[model samples]
Target chain A: MNLGILIAGLLTLAIYSFLYKDNPVYRAAESLLIGLSIGYTLVLFWQSTLFDKLFYPLLREHGIWLTIPLILGLMMFSRLTRKWSWLSRIPIALMIGAGAGAAIPAMLYARTLKQVSATVHPLIMENGGFDISAVVVVIGVLTTLAYFYFTREHKGVMGKMARVGTYFLMIFFGATFGYTVMSRLSTLIGRIDFLLGDFLHLLK
Target chain B: MNSNKTRWIIYSTLLIVVVLSYLLGINLITHPSPEVQKSYTFIENLPESSVVMVSFDHEASSLPEIQPISLILLRHLFRRNLRVVGLSLFAEGTAIGYRTLTKVAQEYGKQYGHDYVFLGFKPQHISAILGMGESIRGVFPEDYFGNKIEEIPLMRKIRNYDDILVVISIADGDRTMQWIEYAGAKYHQRIMAGLTAAMITTYDPYLASGQLSSAVGGLKGAAEYENLYGRRGMGNRGMVAQTAAHIFIIVLIVIGNILYFKNRSKGGGNR
Candidate 1:
């Protein structure tokens, strides 16, 4: 058995041992995974982002314009200081403003306008048959939106629509839950494959 | 039985079933869902030598579900002789992306700088996406291995999003939304995603709007792509175990519900 596989197998078993009871073995494995992940991420940040994007530009390319961001990034460290903690807010505000400014128009076109247009498609298809699914989607979107209309109490026709909306919401949630299970199960199957095929050589 | 004992029994049973499914090579025939088929056909119809950017936007934790998706797609792209430019938006995905790309590229006998180039991870994903619209080399001066982008033969032709045919963001989270919003909506890049099963529904609206060209989701999606690619891989094998595990869970749920109802009728205390 390869040493790497052996170590991986041990860690897998250690993590699975938690099903019986939490123990030092599981704790050790958990800590190792967390530590290794953090270490890897820090190195990647330095090599990929900070070193290439920041340091190399400042030193080698002599891109003096890069210092503005450099200063702003450094101001983020003011969060650690008692008196200068307010300085951190400058960068935070800038990030939030820039992010939102960049995001809003795209979100409007991609998420809002496009979604609304899709929902409110032509009731009749080009082939001339009534687009039943399109009508259902339009109704579903309207009723669901109405359900969140808190200004008026849900009663009479509104109550009926809200009830229908609840059913649609329930179906959506159920489908999401089912897929979530499949997602997690796929992860489990992956580990099982690694253990049997890679680690133990129990399977081809 | 004690709840802890019951839990242990359940876990052991689940593990055994999955392992046995793998060992026995249990095959479950599956048809490609429409969404997955759409994604397959999108790639299938791509012109040869078209540049495709694959953003590995996931981490190690979600690798089990997402890796097969990435691998299958990469295989298909390489098989078609497509120029793949790999990059990552997430820090954790940087190394994971490189490893997966390298492994698949080797299997296809692809040269690194000529056939595929990994641009590594970029911070501020929104800016990076926009920057790629202007100049990919400007955003990533150095490839993942610290080689100048200008030196890479593949990178020479690919200057911006316009030069690329499509961008596939294989992700576990909502990073695909950023790709769609910035890269697809703003830059008019054809964007697709290979998402974890849990995230498929979230992108349905984008798919409907044609903002996202298509998406392959979860292990099932990978399996579909593998079938399309005419090769059986981890996706096929993993699906068997997944089916077995799902059946096991369903059986357990039914039995538990039956037992609970029976006990309730007998006025037994909740346990």
Candidate 2:
């Protein structure tokens, strides 16, 4: 018997036992999973970030200049104590400022300008034919933007357009929900496959 | 019927159908999406020995879905004689990426540091991505297994995004968006994503804008990729069970709707 597979299979069964009833076995397995996750994440960060990136660089590779980030990272820990909590804000502000500075132009280009440029194509094609898909997209974009326009009361033409926008929104949400269900089923199939194939060896 | 009883019945039926599907060995037909085809063709067309960066930007929870996609893609990459540099933007995927990489590499009879090398996990994903674009070696001074990156033959030749042919992000969440915005948009590096089903629509804007080169999402996408790759794997097998479950759920939905309508006609509606 493979001890690892046996233990994992049992834990999987314990977790699935919740379907029958919420019991101590299920709770114990859930706690163990959560604990293991936190422990693993902590260890990963300690090795990857705290030790390798910070300490290694500070002591060995880069030397004194690395202390700047180390200090900023240490300041993040100040939030634990009320007396030094104000120090935490310094790093927070710097992060926000730097993050925004980096993100603004990139986000603007990727999310805004490129999107607008792509969407604002000519409704008429080069072959002198009507682009029905472009028409639908244009309508969808206009109506959806109108739906979020809260400056004026939704009345008359605006109301109809917003109503159309709601239809598009519903279609999007339905598609998303459908995909979510498919992904969940996929995950379930994966677990079952493991149990049948690897653990039980019943699968060919 | 009591609601709890109905729920249990549904669960039992699902379990039975899935088990049967597995035991009976059903295979579902899958069509390749244009997006997946684009990704395949791009990699298929890349000249031999081209360096490609594959980032595992997903946590462990979604590994079930993400792993098969990564596995098949890695198979294709290795089959085409591409040199792959693996890394994880999300910390949890570090071990998962390494395991998958090694598994696929062994199948191809590829040696480490020559054919491929895993550069491990990096925190602050945005910063890591930007840093890589500037200098990959500067960001990850050491590979995952504590080897100095400079010592690796593959690492010695690759410097930054300029040397990389494309960046493929296997993700379960929005890390692909960061890759698109920062790496693709800012640095002009080509980007593609193999992601979870739920996040497909979230990347549509990027896909439309050409910021994301292509995306293969959900199990369907994976199955399609398997078809293109011409090898049956977990993806194709999972689809059989998935079809059964979907049909079963639709039947339940139809039955529920009929009952609700019948009750309403009798003026006994409890909706």
Candidate 2 lDDT, B97-150, residue by residue in tens: 999999999999999999999999888999999999999999899999889999
lDDT of 1 by residue, A107-193 (tens): 899888877877778999999999999888988897897788889899999988988899889888988999999999999988888
Interface RMSD after interface superposition, model 2: 1.1
Model 2, A111-134: lDDT tens per residue? Answer: 888899989878999999999988
Deviation from native of the Cα of residue B256 in model 1, angstroms? 3.2
Residue by residue across B124-143, what tens digits does model 1's lDDT show? 89999988899998899888
Among these predicted structures, which one has the highest DockQ?
1
Give me the overall lDDT of model 1. Answer: 0.90
Off by over 4 Å in 1: B263-271
What ranges in model 2 sit over 4 Å off?
Answer: B268-270
Go through the candidates in order and give the clash count of each: 0, 0
| Colliding residue pairs in candidate 2 | none
* DockQ for each numbered candidate: 0.80, 0.80
- TM-score, structure 1 vs. true: 0.96
